[model samples]
Target: MSIKKCRQEFEKIFKKYPDKTQALLPCLYVAQEKCGCLTEEIVSFLAQRLDLPKVEVYSVITFYSMFSFEKKGKFVIRICMSLPCYLRGSREILEAVVEEALCIKPNQSTEAKKFTIEPVSCLGLCDIAPAMMINKKIYGNLTPQKAREIIRRYKQEKDK
Candidate 1:
């Protein structure tokens, strides 16, 4: 479907919320779901549809790390790097997973076009330290081997 079609669907979601501000998150989510990332064009389109200033939309997008202006890989891998995860050898796990799956450093995508590896601040799963998110699903209590296995499984599922 085209971005215009996505925007029309987003308009329906926006209509459900009593306030335009309340629709921001869902609207952005729909935008990302349709376009894979929030680019300048999408942001401008949102601002126009929501009747908000472009700067307002841009500020909101910039303030949130969850929003991406650039195109992401098919899989967006977020490895937790907060205190608990740090103490739990998250770095090693991150390295192993990235090397094995994407063959690139953190914040890089593989040449094979399969995955992107990134170090995230926290996933609010500190209790499970060394957690990571694949797309939106959280994986906790990760070891280097577990990370590799998870990536393999995800790739297999995506292939299917």
Candidate 2:
């Protein structure tokens, strides 16, 4: 669907809430789903639709790391860098994954336009240390080899 269609759907959802302020979260989510990141254009569009000031929308977007103002790759790879994951070799795994998959450092998007690698804090799955989240799916007990395999599968699916 186009971004315009997504915006219309978001406006419809915003109308359901008694207060436009309460619709902020869902609106942002819709924006992300539409554009892959919450761009300034989307924020302004949302502000106009909800009759809210641009500052309010911009503030929320800036405050939330989940909302990216810049473009991201088709696949977002979030590697857990918390204590548990680190102790379990998350660093090495992250390095290998970035080098092999994206050929870029963390917080960088690949030239292929297929993947983006980021070092995330805790994924809240310490029991399953060395975990990584692809898009939104969490994979635990990760190894460098396993990470590569998962990336391959994701690339194949994205290609289809």
Candidate 3:
């Protein structure tokens, strides 16, 4: 890992927040962008910079679904399972992802590492009930066929 770059990015984000605690999430994002996942080095760096305990850092990261400790596939597909989404046929949406789309189970990545499927409690897109997020983008009001096509298009995208 490039400590210099990491420190530069960390400090850049660190300066944006008056409350250092408010900076924790953005700092973690910078580290994750560089390393693909959080490392022990990142935890130590963040804790030292934020003047917080390592356990505190761990707790914060674990509580947020956006922060991943493990390196995910090229695309992370998060399906919503919240009540609003559930009422809107999210179960069918999940089945579409598993059966018609990637054919991979939740919390597992495809053999080719193209996608990792996850069942998230909520994406806070209640208005777009029955939504799924691929990486940072959201897709909503989906049918099985639409989900399959979406996955096919994503599969065709070259690694960035």
Candidate 4:
């Protein structure tokens, strides 16, 4: 979707709030979802639309981990590197499963731009340690093989 189109859709969301400042977070989410990431252009455009200072918009965007400031792949693979997942051998999974299978290390997107591997903090699934999330879906208690299978499925779906 074009930025103009996204801004048009945002107009409806913006209308819900009498105070445009109250619309900041939801407006940012809408922009991020539509534009794939929050670029400088998008941020500036949002500030103008919301009638807020650009610094205010940038500050909010920078504070949230869910909101990406840089371009990311369609599928972002976030492996939990918290204490529980670490104890469950998340390091091994990071190296063996993500790196070897996808040929992309943590914080790197695949050359084909299909996926990005990120090592994040706790994802609240400590009972099922060594958990990882692809987009919003969490897979836990993973073996290297299971991770490989998940990646394969996504790749196949993308291919199709």
Candidate 5:
């Protein structure tokens, strides 16, 4: 993810769409992919590059869960709160994450910035139910004890 690569990608996005507005999402993705998080600096750069209003960029990023305006923890824990997962004890799993273990709440990172808990719409693992994903690795069929144990293991990991 280099600046040169982002410029190239932006050029392609601009060429593909007749309307500059149409290139916003792709340009945002390209910039975010290169910059890690879409901070104010990156957002400004993207706005100027894409010929968009800064507010428009901000609005779009805020609306999309996929975009991040600030840096997240090394490990992002996404707990599914979908109806299926909720019915199967996802609430207990969330409580286990918040009150029982890590004091951090949803969308907040630990002090060390090691883990961030994000309550997401779904993980598409309804069959397993009560599922959570740490980074890209999925954990499912969880009880509170199981959830605590999994968190402990991640906490002990030397190389995140």
Candidate 6:
């Protein structure tokens, strides 16, 4: 998407918020969706557009694990590493994904650029435990076999 288009989308979202600051998060989300990841150019554009300090925009990106400042694969697989997930065999699930599926460790993207495996602190699915997110979809109560199957489905999707 073009920068002009992004700005237009931001304007639409910005108009809905009573306070300009309240629109920051949603605007950033829209920017990320358009640009894939939050590049420096995108952050600078947002800072200028919102009349906020560039540092403030960068801070929000860094504070939220969901926001990526660097390039990520088409499918970013986020495995939960919080205590609840860990206690429920998330470690094994991670190993299965890394070893049997993508062949890339956490924080690494596959050579084909199809997937990026990341270990996040939480996915807010503690009740289910052992959860992971691929893009915006969450899968919980996972075992190693299920993780592999999910990875397989994504890989197939990439082929399509």
Q: Which one wins on TM-score?
A: 6
Clashing pairs counted in every model: 0, 0, 0, 0, 0, 0
List clashing residue pairs in candidate 1.
none
Clashing pairs in 5: none
lDDT string, candidate 4, 1-160, tens digits:
3477477778888889879888889888887777777877777888898889999998898777667876788998888888999998898888865666788778888787789888889989999999999988989999877888888898888889
User: Over the full model, what C-alpha lDDT does candidate 5 score relative to the true structure?
Assistant: 0.82
lDDT of 5 at 40: 76
**Per-residue C-alpha lDDT of model 3 across residues 1-160, encoded as one tens digit per residue:** 5455578888788788868888889898887777767888888888888888999999999988767778778888999988999998888888988888788898888887778888898888888888999988899987767778888888778444
Q: Which 10-residue window in model 3 sums to the lowest lDDT?
A: 1-10
lDDT of each model, Cα atoms only? 0.81, 0.82, 0.83, 0.83, 0.82, 0.87
For model 2, the run of ten residues with the poorest summed lDDT: 1-10
Lowest summed lDDT over 10 consecutive residues: which window, candidate 4?
Answer: 1-10
Model 6: residue 67 alpha-carbon error in angstroms: 1.4
User: In model 3, which regions exceed 4 Å deviation?
Assistant: 1-5, 158-160
lDDT of 3: 0.83
Q: State the lDDT of candidate 5 residue by residue for 1-160, as single tens digits.
A: 3455467877888899868788888887877666656777666766887778999989999887657876677778888999999999998999898777788898898887788888888888999999999877999999989999988888878355
Q: TM-score of model 5 relative to the true fold?
A: 0.75
Candidate 1 deviant stretches above 4 angstroms: 156-160
Off by over 4 Å in 6: none
Q: Please give each candidate's TM-score.
A: 0.86, 0.82, 0.90, 0.82, 0.75, 0.92
Clashing pairs for model 2 are none
Task: For candidate 2, write residues 64-133 as lDDT tens digits.
Answer: 6567876788888999998989999999889878888657888888776678888988988899989999
The 10-residue segment of model 6 with minimum total lDDT is 1-10
- Provide the lDDT at 39 for model 1: 75
